[model samples]
Target: MFTHVDAIAGQLGRGLLLTLAMTALAFTGAVAVGLVVAVLRICPVAPLRAFGAGYVTVFRNIPLLVLLVLFVFGLPDLGLLYPLFATVSTAMALYWAAFVCEVVRSGVRAVPRGQAEAARALGLGFGQCLRHVILPQAVRPMVQPLGSIFIGCALSTSLAAAVGVAELTGQAEFLTLRYDQPLTSFALTTVVYVALTLTSGLVAGRVERKVAVVR
Candidate 1:
């Protein structure tokens, strides 16, 4: 029973690598996309703001599983044949990007209006004001909330298994079927997920504390 774990140890390692790869790539992409959405949502232009708001509302409402399926199948029909890994990572990034935009929006809002006014009074344009004065302060308050978002993004990678990315959960399923030890296989999968999540939370917590402002 327990020996089945040893039989597929190499597969387990590869599965973990895939899961981590998805999480890392997706989170990085989400942050970049989400930051742009946040800026668009808050910018002075009405149309841009509307576009940003609509994007967040639509993507946030869609199910992750649906996005994964769409990326894998729908994109191919549209003449774009993204690989399984690319499709899954892009889907997860888009899904998480909506939420990350909201988190970042709140952070941007936390900045004092006076800062932007000061920057503008100094003859700086809107972009300069945001870059030099507003964003520096806004980013400070966003540490904790964004940490939670990061953990959520990390766990969301599990859904990639549905599209055959063969991440951690997928490996367990394959192993269980091959070895006929459902309980042992899945039990280990649960532990691995828990460990990954806990480690992520810890790292985020440390980084948050490091950047936290006392005032």
Candidate 2:
């Protein structure tokens, strides 16, 4: 049934590469932004904490499609025109960062209060305490949540197709129309997506088993 996929393997492969690139780049940015937001959420500074909470509350509630539209069209009039890849990556990254931040904040909260206090007993400042003691312990539990968030981030890149990014779903749709074979084209696409998600879960399992602390 899925016959056209073989003829378009090169095109699909290119699309897959673009999808992976967008996902990897966006996830990298998400990790950085999420870490900062997470740290700010738990920091001693009240204003920073409020800002972090506001950021999460806003971004997490907004539809990712709206964010993609904003990056693609809204920013251009604001004199912040980016190339298509950059536009999609930024939108996807920022959209997912809110969720990632919350995941990390939960991990931080899972850490015992005594850990921070003991670091303070060593004359460490709040940042140093987080760096040397609390976060180190907190990060172990974070691996699973972070992995899931990133998987969602990868899947979310499909939204970028509306802005002409030519990611996996976009290519599948295009091929479907071109070959007049929606069943075959999309079936293969579904298989690829399932494989990717399964691989992500397996990797997350390995990481969780290896480094997860039972607390």
Candidate 3:
């Protein structure tokens, strides 16, 4: 059993790397889109607000696997195409973006109304106030939620295996079948995931402490 573990370690490491890479890229994209949508959700313009609300409603409600299928299997016939990993990453970003948007919006809303009022009183436009005042304060509260989103996004990368991206879970599946060692293969995979999530939690905790509101 131990020898089998050693033999498969390299393959599992590569899969882990792929999972990490996809999660990092997808989470970055998710944050960017989420931030934009969140701004739209709060902006004064009604149409932009409606578009933001609709986007959150649509993506937040869709199952990630369904989104994956639509991107991987449903898009090519319409002449839109992407590499397997790229397709999966896009789906993950779009799906996770909804959650990220809500987290950010909530953080923004948590700021005292006086802050925005004061900024506006000084003749600062919405964008200027948000960029310099609202967002900096909002970010301290956002660290943990954003970190949770990152961990969730990391787990979601496993779904890429369904479309043949050969990420962590996919490699575990391959090893399980190849060696008839489901217990060993999956135990290893589970440990890796636990480690990843725990690390995320620890980092979030540290950041939260560092940015703790003095009041």
Clashes found in each candidate (C-alpha, N, C closer than 3 A): 0, 0, 0
Residue 88 alpha-carbon offset, candidate 1, angstroms: 0.8
Q: How many angstroms is residue 214 displaced in model 1 relative to the true structure, after the best TM-score fit?
A: 4.4
Stronger candidate by TM-score (1 vs 2): 2
Model 2 residue 25 lDDT?
Answer: 91
TM-score of each: 0.93, 0.94, 0.96
Location of the lowest summed lDDT over 10 successive residues in candidate 3: 1-10
Tens-digit lDDT string for candidate 1 (111-171): 7778788889889998898887777777767777777777788778888788887898899
* Model 1 residue pairs with clashes: none
Clashes of 1: 0
Consecutive 10-residue window with the lowest summed lDDT within model 2: 1-10
What's the lDDT of the predicted structure labeled candidate 3? 0.92
Arrange candidates by TM-score, highest first: which order? 3, 2, 1
Q: lDDT tens string, model 2, 44-144?
A: 99999999999999999989998888779899989987798998898888888899899888888889988888889989998999898887788778988
Which residue runs does candidate 2 get wrong by more than 4 Å? 1-6
Residue 156 displacement (Å), model 2 = 1.0
Which ranges of candidate 3 are over 4 A from the true structure? Answer: 1-6
